[model samples]
Target: MVVLTLAFVSTTLDLTLSDHARKERGWALSWSVVRSWRALTAGTPRPRPSAPDLRTFDGLRVFCMMAVILEHVCWLASLSYVADARYSELTRRDYDAMLMTNSTLVVQIFFLMASFLLAHKILQQRRKNLPLMKTFFETILNRIVRISPSNFVVVWFVATWMERLGDGPLWKPLVGGEAAVCRRKWWTHLIYMNNVIYPDDKCLIQTWYLAADMQLYVVALLATLLLRGRRAAVPLLAGLFIFVTGINFTLACLWRLVPTFVLHRPESVLVAYGGEPSFNVLYQSPLGNASASLAGLLLAHLHHALGDAGVRIADHKVFRAVSVLCAPAALGWAALSPRLLGGGVPHPMAAAALAALERPVFVLLVTVALLGAINGVKSWWRTWLSHFGSVAPRLSFGALLLHLSLNKALLATRLQPIQLDRPHVFFQWFGVGVLSYSAAIPLALLVEFPTQRLYKEVTELINKYKQPTQDIKMDT
Candidate 1:
């Protein structure tokens, strides 16, 4: 409450301050907290540079985040002593259940976009003859700066104060239990290794994605650096895809792991998948999840390569047709994912094949779709996604961090078991989405944006101080 109050006060002050006053004061760390709200509340779109317009990604990410939120709502509903105890089991037998089950694929889009943008940025830097080592360090620094402060604050809040919000029969075990584990194991999250070290004992289990992503980021950067030239890049990326595919296939077969988290799981394990070996071995492993990131890197390399050669994909009818066809194919694949794996019990070969191909195939199709959209594939769907999906992405990361907790809090406060139906689950999702995004606004304004602004200010000051030394050296 105190933190939220401070954020409100700072945002209010930021709104009242004039432009001149802001320019004079914005550099101060304290004032950056206030000035951050200007961007948050701004009506204008941020200007784009010569780089590819990724506003489309903003929409993609926001949509994925909402889908994940809806999944969590359904998950929590399944966990509850629901009025309709059989709903989870029966729902899985339907076609629409595939939508919820395969929605986990949306997470890969984030992984894909991360590597794609990283490759794109590095390619641009290479054109300007930037130092690879310097760019590498800067990338690490910027990622940490962007992600850590808000993450730390959220972790601390969950650990210390979340249980204080409310209490019920399940509050202690569901809410307080998590907080207690966080009190002891929070360092794993801060270091971004909890996914590897104790895959099950998590402060916020959903955050395993962060650990996987950070680990993959380092691996991708290192690979990009070592295999710097175009000659080495092709074999390196292709070999990486084959290598990761083999690992996923081998692990799935050896461990008999489920291909995806939502598939082949009993109704009892719906909520957290707490004791599921598949969750530990396949779901959280960086290597297991590398296909999407690899797909992103591959697409990015091609994008830059095409741009350098003055080739527009849209100009080629064949390429455009293939790209346009990917959208429906991807949708159909997702919708029938359960059937693809043989929903109840699959043959060993089929399960292994699904593990090997699931992410790569889906990611490839989605990457193609993304390529089309970016390269001027016009459609009403793309138009809607671009416009409506842009702004919410600003809050998407914060919402991701907080949504599960909000869902848990809501359920923890419930005195009666929820009626597990589509309508009720939708209502839960709606309420949780509002609460999560509402909480995220203050979180972003307070911690995330201010930290970014302060980091930029500090870097600028250091750069200014170094300029004279560089000039003097040049003169000498």
Candidate 2:
């Protein structure tokens, strides 16, 4: 009713008021929104952001993005035990082939990429001498706007509409928990607290990431403020990184926690093993994931410092060898991590320490490897990877938001889950990706892209107004 009333009033004022009066009453803001909507939907569309593009970075994003989708597809398929009798067969077939379900590890890459790009951008802004307060809010709020509009629409649908659209042996189980949680605590997600409160009853299941990343972004920006224009920034950042590592070490050692996806196991596990096994404690907290983002930030700082100093790792054979080896080493480490820790309790004390250090270790390996890839290193492997990665950065977020629900919707409509096979899984992944990307294109264009432009224009307007006011005050 409030929304309707606001819509009515805005339309009425637009129809009834003069331009000057509308401007005076701040009705123009509403009309500007109207115009933005029209322009986004019908006008010349804005171009993709043209910041210095690193094919390797974007390309890596594309790879990780697809990996995330594939991971979830495999996961949700495994869960069709809720509907299909052959579920164990399905799981055995996939597990029979060694498909691990702990795909949540891809999120660490995302955290790193997000902070890496953000650090680079904010460093540019600092070079331009952007104000600290404005920079902080603009950085944080821009991220919110980027994710929230589509998130709100999706959450609303999940809560109010998703279950009603389908009914089956599978539909209730697949959608029920998520729908119930969103109905109760969607606001927590809106403000990045989803992981902290009743995390077992997670709404979208995937959104724990957004929450952790948002919390980390706030930390990153505050740290950025401290580092701005400081000669001692690197040392200070290193000190902060050590402090964060210490905190994570303390948490792991205190609880002897293992990192596992909350969803991969039966919901019963969440109840049976409450404290350390609880998703909220080990997997979902900002502290649990802080190393990846901070590592990315540190890498971004190093990249910037190197660029300013005219250093090129690409031409150096030793650096190139290290970069070449880093890729397989990271991949091997991740692939072997499960066996190293073995996905259960009673890990060796060494394994516990490895679990704590694994995150930062993975961060180092990836950042170093990708830095070489993105830095024009002229490697054939990078060239091959970059081909797929170039568009990943833009499309990845949209795909992430769309894929989980798309997977649910697809499964809910299935009369019976198919028996698992390599061929079947491949086809399922390909088809779902096709549909998800198709839906994501318009969502990105109509909703995500335009809101970003409108936001940028608004901030530019604020800066414009502030400059004139500053001039007036100075003259006075």
Candidate 3:
């Protein structure tokens, strides 16, 4: 209620601003629903080298988000009372089930991307001679402002109105159960400690990624500052990656945990596995996942250090061939290795090694692909991604917040058990993807963009006041 009301009032004020006032407050006009909608729907053209846009990631992020929703869709379907009791189990035993089992690792791409963009932005800002401390504080503030409004709206909606929205045999347990958790532990989310503090009972369980990302962001930022312009930076990142990987390996071995989710677990057990000790202690831990963040920071520095020469190397025929083969191979190995390791059988040492290397290998491949994209590698894939670059990136964050809730609502509203099959699951995913992105539009335009604009305006006003003498001198 509060979020919607504020969005409405802000939109009205922005739209009603007179031409003269609008001209004077041009940047502030970003609070306008009209402009925000345009930005959220437009397709941006490819930019020249000088453009600041990371267009490659726009489609990548949006697609990755959609995939996450699909994963949940599959998981939820498996959890629900399906017509065929054996469907979920049979499907998981199939060789192709590796995709679903390993899909969780797709999130590593996001961790890498977030840190990569942050490091890149900080490096660029540093070139303007800004104080490092100011940049650090501003970065933190900006991230909070960008992420919080949509997040708050989501959390608030779940805790308050979600149960009222739908009901069925499964509604209370599926949707209301989560809402109950949200109401009790919403404060953990506000502090970005939900993942660490309450490993098993997260309100929006998918947001464990956000908590891990936030924690890693702070650590990565501090490391960036300490090692800025230092030659030892790469070595330190390498060491961190190894250290994090070792922790994952050690914990997986000690806990006798699988490298990834054991695909062949009973459908009932699989659904409840999220709260299992393995996931809480190791799987979602920032320490276990820090390698991806470090990888991102390393990639950003390497890109900045390499410049155009790196682009030439990426474009080389030999290098391109090797990359083409190597990247997919790495992903394939990460996807299939756990299943090949006896499907979480009593091979603790082997499972431990797989757990340790699975994400790192995937992150390595993603880093290579990102490097290629950043260097403007020509491909049909890159071209398709660029087409949606303008709008999707803006909505990706909102979609992340809203998709899970939306999916649960969709499932809970069903009057009967769904048929569980690949085609049915795919159909459900298509609907969820369309609806999730559609729902995200309002959240982004109303809550996320407006909050960001308001924050920027307030910061600029503060800076203006702080430099009053400079402004007066300029006027003179």
Candidate 4:
């Protein structure tokens, strides 16, 4: 009788345990499905990977962010400061300052940042033997979802409400026209093809950077796949550099396009692209802007290699010398750039040389300097700036999306012109930057931050399930 009772109790426990296991699995699956649906419909899975921070790079970002705001301040001030004067007519100092402001080069820094971060993460994943195709798909999706929501906020507001906000001389051309263009071509901005779809000032004029970034991101995925395990990284990089630079050079010469940023174009370059100064299709396209990103890819490889080898190139005199020289080189090129292009189209060879060398040159120089910082050499000011920069991981993208809208609103509402060349101009720019940043914070916290968090959570849940599959050896 006792033995019989023992057997029955054992059987009961077994059934209960089995039942519990089944229920657990079902619950997990259901939860995963719900998360997936929510992520797909209402949010996206955010990814937060554990990676070392390159602080100087962070500092560089801070500097660049402010530089962009300052550039626009001067630009807008030039337009509004002299209420009755044409912007085309400029004083000697204004002209010289305009020619020398290389602030727009900071845009290239954005592409470099994106490329470096993504490439670094991709190579790290590859080391864990993650499926390349799956990773490639996820990376692209992640990028799109990450950038889209915040982008849509700005795009939607511009199209629907900005024109109604205010009116000035700059109002109709800048606001009303932009609203019309965006309302009509919002899809292009949604997909990051605004630069290609609508060439002129319709929609967010500054979003060409975003468009170029997304397009180049796709290209990077393909490149990452091709260079898996670093097998083809070198040759692939070489070919990409040669091809992208060669093509840009060929086209610049063909179109007689100048190499300066839109804000500081040489007169001849202006006529070449029909007076729309800035990176139009010929310069702003993914094809033209890709060399900077490719250089970033190469830098990523070098960064990984240095980590594995545990060596600091900055310790070597020759390498240190090269890194030190980068600053002066960049400054020198920027100052002389206006002279290089002259008033009209430069000599064909000169134009070709500037176009071919411009991107890769700065990228290489910047990488070298960045490499030094990564290896633990940093100035005190750099350290401080980096600390400040690290505090706002989401700020840059937020500012990029928000600043233009803010600028449009401010420029449109002004009853009088902004004073462009006054001694207090620097303070005015500082104020504008503060306002831009302040506006960006809410967007970052509410829209950008939440979306990123949702993405990370869903991704983690999905990966948790994927682990078991990953652990099982597949038949290759």
Each model's RMSD to truth, in Å?
2.7, 5.5, 2.8, 11.0
Error of 2 at 230 (Å): 3.7
Per-residue lDDT tens digits for candidate 2, residues 76-155, read 77666434435543453233233344445667888888888888878876768877887788778888988987777677
lDDT, candidates in the order shown: 0.77, 0.68, 0.76, 0.65
lDDT of 3: 0.76
TM-scores of the models, in the order given: 0.92, 0.81, 0.92, 0.79
> How big is the positional error of residue 444 in model 4, measured in Å on the Cα after superposition?
1.3
Candidate 3 per-residue lDDT over residues 285-356, each given as its tens digit: 888788899999998877766662344646588656655565566557655776657743547677666767
> How do the candidates rank by TM-score, highest first?
1, 3, 2, 4
Cα deviation of 438, candidate 3, in Å: 0.7
TM-score for candidate 1, please give it.
0.92
Write out the backbone clash pairs for model 2: 58-389, 59-389
Rank candidates by lDDT, best first: 1, 3, 2, 4
Which is the winner by lDDT between candidate 3 and candidate 4?
3
Residues 127-191 of candidate 4: C-alpha lDDT, one tens digit per residue = 67777778788788888778898899889888898788787777886578668878999998877
Best by lDDT: 1
